[model samples]
Target: MPVESLPLFPLHAVLLPGAALGLRVFEPRYLDLVRECGRAGHGFGVCLIIDGEEVGAVASAAAFGTEAVIEDFNTGDDGLLTLQVRGRRRFHVHKVRVRDNGLQVADVSWCEADPVEPLQPEHGLLATLLHEVIDKVGGEHSKAPESHFDDAAWVGWRLAEMLPLENAQRQVLLQTGDPHQRLQQVLALLPE
Candidate 1:
């Protein structure tokens, strides 16, 4: 896999592959990130902040993250930059450095993407639960492709994002490589 240097956006939230994230950009550094990404037609990485705040200083972030591709953008009434982004792929941060402008840039290796695997019969519980969760949310996922509940990776990511799991737990699920294994991890976390 190729190692690429990517600008990191550390947030208090976790974004799994195929999940959606909304970010408000008021910091100049992140504003620069949006501009740079727009100009290059590139995406940035979103990692969970393990320490420090999202503003002023660079925060310590988890090594695993999802590449956030900008899907839409608009200026809020307050004049802040609002971004609608979707998680593309997962990456492992090998090393990180602080730029002069305080942006935390990481040299990351892209993880192999999940192969298409239909949901297993044993994992059908996850698919049904996922359907209930999305219905309760009133279908706010138009931006996400029509839910492919039969797809193992799709089912796992949708649940990972909707489940009331802690950021650390969510990060662990994101790092799981095999789609079926990831579904098993999610099942283990469910209440009996």
Candidate 2:
């Protein structure tokens, strides 16, 4: 396992690998985090908040998290920073240190990359469901390449995000190490 210290952005949300997250930055601590990441050419860690809120105080967060890299940034009409970020990889936090400015810096071990597994015949329904979701929701996912629909990991992540699963459920999916196993988990979560 590769270990490194990263700026942690603990939120009430879960960011899965390959998922895109849009964020509005106004908090000073997170603003500092964005700036630091921009300067260092690395992204910050996003974990589900286990306790406390998004703003003020360093909240207790889940041990497993995803590394988010900035994809785009600009100032919104309201003057706050708007950012587009994409989840890169999963990690597990070993230790956390709070800065004087209240940003939580975590020493995390990066997990192995998810393998590219083709969608199995049993999970074809899941890929079909994801396609239906894209047709209805029609956002970034609508633009995803056709290859994504055939990928077990991509199909599972999209389904996990599109479904009405709780944050904890999303975290569980993120922590699932195998791509094919993730599809199995998603299958069990669907309405029968």
Candidate 3:
């Protein structure tokens, strides 16, 4: 598999494919990263912080992550940048390098896209619950027009976004390339 070098942003949260995340930018390294991404018309990788904090110290990040593209940008009254990023694809980190400013650069391989399969009848409840959760979230965070609740890959990705799973659990789901397997894992974790 071919590997690509990507700038990494380790956070306390997991970014799933097809989900949107809003971040407040203040750290100088991150600010520069955002600018570079914008200038290059590219995205950065967001990995779950396995150890350490988002500030100061160089943190250990999960090997699996999603590439996030900037969807919108705004400047807060406090002079901080508020960015809205939409998750694109999953990647596996092979190597990492930390810059002097604490930014992590990763050598990553993109995961193959899962084949789409219609939602199984037994999983109807999961689709219903996902719609409810999206409704509760409201606004642009709600389901997209192309959202296919009937498709297994779509359902799994949406559930990964809405379910109240730990960041680690969500990371696992993101790393799962098989949609049906991902959904099965999620179903097993859901309340009886």
Candidate 4:
């Protein structure tokens, strides 16, 4: 498969497919990255920071990450850019290079989409919980017309996002391509 190059944004958070993430952009390199992505109508890659800080120096990032597209953009009173991004696809980094300005560019291969499966009866509680959370959040973050609650992949993704899992745990979940297996992992971590 041919590798696609992406601009990487390594942070302490994990972004799962179908989830939304909010970011405050201040650094010059990131501001340029956001602008370029917006101009080209392309999404950027987001990986969990394994070491170092989000600002200053190049941080170590997880191999697997998700592609994030800008959904909303605003300039804050402090002259920083506030962005709402939605996760679209999962990718695995094959190689990485840091630019002079501290931006990381990665050659990545996209992960295969999980096979569709209906939500099992045992996962009813998870669906209910997700529905309640979405209701509270509202707007585009809310449940879609197709009703993802019945989809095993969607249910697992939503649970993985809402769960109080560590960044490493969330990265594991994001890398997992099997919806059923992901749900089983989430179930194991869920409280009674």
For residue 192, what is the lDDT in candidate 2? 75
TM-score of 3: 0.93
lDDT of 4 at 93: 98
Off by over 4 Å in 1: 140-147
Better of 2 and 4 by TM-score: 2
lDDT of each: 0.90, 0.92, 0.89, 0.90
- What's the lDDT for candidate 2? 0.92
RMSD of each: 1.8, 1.2, 1.7, 1.8
Error (Å) of candidate 4 at residue 112 is 0.6
Candidate 4: regions farther than 4 A off: 132-142
Lowest lDDT 10-residue stretch of candidate 2: 152-161
Q: What's the lDDT for residue 187 in model 1? A: 96
Local distance difference test, candidate 1: 0.90
Q: How does residue 50 of candidate 1 score in lDDT?
A: 92
Candidate 2 lDDT by residue in tens digits, 16-68: 88888999999999999999999999999999999999987779999999999
TM-score-sorted candidate list, best first: 2, 1, 3, 4
TM-score computed on alpha carbons, candidate 2: 0.95
TM-score of each: 0.94, 0.95, 0.93, 0.92
For candidate 4, write residues 102-136 as lDDT tens digits.
99999999999877788888877778887887788
Per-structure clash totals for the candidates? 0, 0, 0, 0
Which pairs in model 2 have colliding backbones? none
